[model samples]
Target: MFDKLKEKLGGFKKVLGGAIEEKEQEAIKAGHVKPEVSIKKEAPESAKPSETVKAPEKAGIFDKLKAAVLEQEFIIEEKSVKDHLWELEMALLESDVALPVAEKIVEAVKAELVGTRRKIGSDTGNIVETALRQAILKVISVDSFDFDGFVKKSNKPVSIVFVGVNGTGKTTTIAKMAERFKEQGYSVVIAAGDTFRAGAIEQIERHADALGIKLIKHQEGADPAAVVYDAIQFAKAKHKDIVLADTAGRMHTNINLMDQLKKVCRVNDPDLIIFVDEAVAGNDAVERAKLFNSAVAFNGSILTKQDADAKGGAAISIAYTTGKPVLFLGVGQSYKDLIKFDPNWLLDRLFE
Candidate 1:
């Protein structure tokens, strides 16, 4: 899912490498540029036999060259670390990491590097690697979620309801989830309860059509609760293995919509209330999560746009603040973009 982003970043890295090399060359030239100098010494005028004197040994060209190279190497090494750390910090900021969160990350990385001794062997690389990993883990560790505990094995079908703010990819996520369930050999059905947006029903319909799954939708501006009720009834009648209900994305501040969402929950009583959020939403994403939790009490989260330049703070902060597991991450816009959330994999990407 992140293939495009990876490729783009690879090209950028190449450009940065060239720039750093040019800077290093310029530094070397400046360092070795010799300055003309005249030395003045006072000598006694007394009539005394001049003693044989020796000229100070001149440093060889090779020695001068070697010293210059070593100096450049040392400068490059220090700059490389600082540059890499700065890149990490910038990437996090671009991904919507809050100012405070970004600051904490930088401080953690600095603390790990300060007063730390590098080993005299290949293990030196390991020490730096370990420190980077630990700092990233510390920031993201608060929101780690496990999917293993929530996997259902019962004969009864599992019900998952998708909720989120408008434009957070709620409907599309449901489509993706349906495709996933179908691939697992489950008879999946969708409840298109997002009756607010025009063409919302059609969007879900197109996905259901593509996946060859059944969908239940009411007329435009229909009561979402009634639609969910009907979908649940159909799932029970058809013995569906799973029912995924898509709800209208509403602002958390809307008490009327929040009440309506509560009504939907009451009617369907879904086994899993999954909140769909865009990964790029940043800190505002955390606030959305908290508001949704107050309204629907979501059981888990499905983060979309993970492949985008998101600082990934939303994923961590939301999970930590709401105390909900992250079930899936949408890494791309494709059907297979939906991936089960793996904390270890996420940690590796963030730190490594």
Candidate 2:
């Protein structure tokens, strides 16, 4: 899924390894080590016949010298580490990582490189690998959450509002969440709050029927917040555990639509407002997430079509841009495609 991003990071690793190797070679060539000459002294030029000179005992002197010579005895500072990191930073940007996130990663690598201790004339690949892993972990783990734990601990009728631009699979993502909650032994209800779209109600109705979950709706052009309120009431009356509300998809720049979302937030006071978007949308998705967060302050996100997104940068950038964790990823069209986002799992996918 993240093939492109993995390739990009691999490139960075190659550059970093090369830079460290070059610096180590430079240190070795600068004669920053003890020579391999023997410990025994030459015979005296005069009076060799009359004076008897004691020869020093060879008590592991050669072993000690070998260890000293082979040891990374020299320390060389590579000032050009910045240059390599700069290339990495550009590569990250090209992969659709946000500018701020990319810069932070580069700075982190730089900090780990400059004036750091290393064995002279030895391969520094492991060192560079560690630094790169740490940098990426820092960038993506800045904001994270435990979704299943949170859902389990939350009060009954745990409401989750789905928000995003049109055609980003908002309603389907809600249906997937409904299935997930149901699988967890929770009674689920779906609120078809997207009244602006012509076929939104029918679309959600199909999912509701298939999942055997109750669907709450009003009509086309009806108030989305009112639909959510009614859904909450129905969940409460029927002892349902969760309410997955689907809001109308609107562009971030639409003032009227954004205001409508604000009203929904004010009215329903949902537990978790999740932003849904396409994984392949790249920077557009990131900008949309930022704008949506600014408008209604979403809790996290669910990215759809992750299987098709080779670069897979939106998954990283969206969290960093909005100061929120990615709750889940929609890998395919099936209900089982909804995979929870785990930072460690993602790290292994990229680094291993």
Candidate 3:
């Protein structure tokens, strides 16, 4: 998928290999290691200047080096296909796949296709494509929450609670979730459980009004658990299909606030606990995930601000570290910007 990035990285392999060989030769010549010889094909006449000249072709050194490296012949059962797979691996690593993770993906790809016999006229590209898909599947671990599964298994009044530290988009994500559920003809209600913030209740109310959904809120500085208890009871009485509760965004280190969140969970008994986080927060997002998981026992994750996060490391790392399935990714501020988690699509976008 990330063909351009792969192509760029592929050009560096030969240069790096040559540098390693030169260093080894220097070590052997200096009596630091035993001399070892490996056969290397000679460069073509066109690649090696026949006679030393003051000025040759005006191509840059990188272009000359690439030409010299390409002159040597190497036997691969499927040269083109192998090259393409190698490029994919490089692109994955460049896109924040840790070294160990990248190595595991490469190993999986090799095991799946490298030694397999194929028909003489068959397209090796197809085999490589299969291997790449399998490799991505292995790294991403797609056995998690399924939206279709949820639709079938969940009963009406599915209660979902949003939990996270402050500034992680918890309140906005609740609005987006409400919008999504409402579009599906499901009656959705939002509970402004974030009673600590002065404007939090009004903010959620504003979204509820805009979406034409019911909102349950309390006065500022009221107990969060009490707010959620009232919301759940209200939703139950009204026969609402879903209840999205937004919790106060407090630091995980605040023991008192963490206990308060636990109380909210205890009171609501939500069907799902989604931990909202900012994708651009990087490693800090991972830390917050850990804290929220400990505080309210989160079931899954929702990453926000992905459109602005170039590194995208938080999504992968948070999922892996927390063992929590990522439920949705917020690409923009619009309601439609929230995307359901698709492992294959995510990998394609990340590497691309």
Candidate 4:
């Protein structure tokens, strides 16, 4: 899903790993640190070098003690590390990460590089990889909720509203959500609240037919809020456990439409409002999410078309910028392609 992003980040990883290895080797050649094979073998007092061969700086007892203290320190040149980190920053930018996000990534890598304590002869590559993995996880999945568990614990007929712009496959994401909930043994009803778009009802209807789930709808150009309210009432009567509402796709700048969305929120009172977007859209998706969130204060989000996403910046940007965890990813066209979002799972895929 993030092939291009992974490719770019892989180069950054090599830069960091290589820089650390280079510094360690320089320390080795300068006799500041021992080789790995000799690390566990301490120099015996009986085997101490003759005075004539002793280093001038360690001739005095206090100097020897100072050298001993310095030997425990692992120093990485900040200037040199910054050079490598600059390359990393550019790589992240080229991967379509937001400028702020890319900067934050570089800062994270730099923070891990400087002032770090490493065993005298440990593998620098492993340390670099571990530090980078941790930084990325911190950026993406800072605070998370278990989607399935949260929904399962919610009250009966819990409403989940989907919001996004046109052509982001928002409706399809809702269908996938419905399919997911149904598989989890929660009876679900889809509310076709996207009354403004032509053929929206038909689209949801087809999915409902295929999934054997019920669809609640109003006429074309009808009140979306009314459709959702009706759906909730129907769910109560049928004892359905969940209501997945599909709202009309509108640009974030459309004041009237955004107002209508607020009215829907007021009337339907969705438990979770998921902001959907295409991962391939890069910062545009991120901006859209921010705008939608400002209008409705979204509970969380769902990213779509992730299987085709290459730059993969939207996933990181949306999470960090919104301070909300991505609940799921639409990896493919099939209903089963919806995958739960996990920060560590994504890190494994990104750095594996």
Candidate 5:
């Protein structure tokens, strides 16, 4: 996962490491910093017998030399940081990162590296990796929502509506959520509110049957708002722990469809509205998320096809673009493949 982004970061590390090493050599030559081997002794053959005294050299000299080398500080110049960041910015853009997001990461990294102090002989790889990871982490750590905590503390029969453009796996994500909720000891009722698309009702029905959860749906051309309302009622009557409503996929430009979605929200007043999109869609996904947020004001997002996403720009940009947390990531096709979003989890994959 995120192989392309990872590769680009690795390239930057190598570039920075080479530049630092060159600077170190130049500093040594110019007498700005002393090299570790500066304290040299005469060869054995050239040493006088008396000077070469019988006793071995005291350990104090060696200790002091080691301490001096460890205490030596190497400064990374600001110009060097700026020079190397252009390549990284281009690489990020090539990986489908938004221009603003790429610029943010680059500036963060530059702040971390420019004029930074490091001990001489420190691992250059570690230095570069730390800067890059922190930069990426800062870009991704937007306002977060704790899905588990919310479900635990909210009133019983938590109602959630899923929305997104078509072919983004919005329906499957609902089933995944239902399975997850059931595993956590919560009864789930699914509302097949996607009444516009052909086979939409049957698709959700198959998932509900397989998961052994009750599903409430209407005919193909019925009003979706009615279906969601009925599902909420069914959950209340049966004392179910949650209601997962699936809405028909519609582009943000489709004014009529968006109005229909608003009606569903108005009537049901769900506890949360989750936006769904594919991670591989890149900048397109980010833009869609922004437009959708403007349309419906969703609470959070769930990114699907995460496993197949090599660029990983969508996952990084969506939360920042929408100002909403990414609650979950669909890593695979299985119901169990959905993982809660975490900054460290993504950093580990990029830097591992």
Candidate 6:
């Protein structure tokens, strides 16, 4: 998924390895530790000593020198890693990482590497990768939310509203969530609350029909808030375990549409508000998430089109921007392609 970022991090690893190696060599040249071979060259035949040196004594000296060299420890100073940090910063920015997020990752890497003690000849690449992984993890794990745990414990017919700008896969994500909940043994009801756009109701109805789940929808130009309210009432009567509402996609700057969204929430009082966006949208996705959170305040986010994302910046930036966890990732076209977001899973994919 994050092919570009993976390549960039690999480059950073090489740079880090070289920097550490150079620092180790500089320490050795400065006589900070004993050399591995300190024994004097065997005397030329013409200048040999009359008495032969003891083999055991010479072997002991060689072992001591080797031990001294292997046991030496070097501290990773910030100066040595400065270039690496700069390169990392540029790489992150180019990958569409938000400014603050890029800065946070850089600072984290510095905190993890600077002044750290490592024995001479340790695996430098492994060390760099570990530090980078932890830094990225810190950036994305700002808030961790367990989707299944919340759904299991929440009251019956837990209502969730999906909000985001247009063309960010909001409808598809709603269908995916409905399938997920159904597979988990919960009866799901879908609300086609996106009444503004033509075919919005038909789009959701097709998914509901395919999934054999009930859908509550209104005709075009109908009040979206009314649709959601009706869906909640239907769920209560039908004993449905969850209600997933799909709202019309609207820009945060659209005062009228945003006001309609507020009305929907105020009237229906959903259990959770999930912002949907595309991972491939990069910095734009991050900005939209921030704006949406400021206006309506979503609980979590679902990032779609991850399978097509080469940079994978939105996943990292959205969590930090919204102070909310990424509940799910839409990986492909199939309903089953929606996978729950896990920090470790992302780290493994990026680093491995």
lDDT of residue 187 for candidate 6: 96
* Candidate 4 lDDT by residue in tens digits, 186-210: 8999999999999999999999999
RMSD of each: 12.0, 10.1, 10.6, 6.5, 9.5, 9.4
Clash count, one per candidate? 2, 0, 1, 0, 0, 0
Stretches of model 1 off by over 4 angstroms after superposition: 1-95, 103-125, 139-149
lDDT agreement of model 3 with the native: 0.67
Q: What shift in Å separates residue 39 of candidate 4 from its native position after superposition?
A: 7.1
Which TM-score value belongs to model 6?
0.88
Compare candidates 1 and 4 on TM-score and give the better one.
Answer: 4
TM-scores of the candidates are: 0.68, 0.85, 0.69, 0.89, 0.88, 0.88
Task: Look at candidate 5 and tell me the lDDT of residue 207.
Answer: 96
**Candidate 6 Cα RMSD after full superposition onto the native fold (Å):** 9.4
Question: lDDT per prediction?
Answer: 0.66, 0.78, 0.67, 0.79, 0.83, 0.83
- Which parts of model 5 are misplaced by more than 4 Å? 25-71
lDDT tens digits, residue span 211-321, model 2: 999999998999999999999999989988999999999999999989999998899999999999999998899999999999999899889999999887788778878
Q: List, residue by residue over 1-352, the lDDT tens digit for candidate 3.
A: 3333334333433333342233333333444333333323442356443321122233432222111111122112333234444654665556554555556666777677543433222233444455655775675663477754685478877888888889888888988988888788788878889989878888888888988888888889998888778887888899888888898998989899898888888877888888999887866887788778877778888999987776655665566667777888988887788988777886566334
Q: Per-residue alpha-carbon lDDT of model 5 for 40-152, expressed as tens digits?
A: 33233443433211222334211111111112455565654665788889999999888898999999988987765665556777888999989888878888678899999
Position 289, candidate 5: lDDT: 93
* RMSD from true fold, candidate 3: 10.6
Error of 6 at 144 (Å): 2.4
Q: For this target, which candidate reaches the highest TM-score against the unseen true structure?
A: 4
Where is the poorest 10-residue window by lDDT in model 1? Answer: 62-71
Q: How far off is residue 18 in model 1, in Å?
A: 19
Residue 235, candidate 6: alpha-carbon lDDT: 94
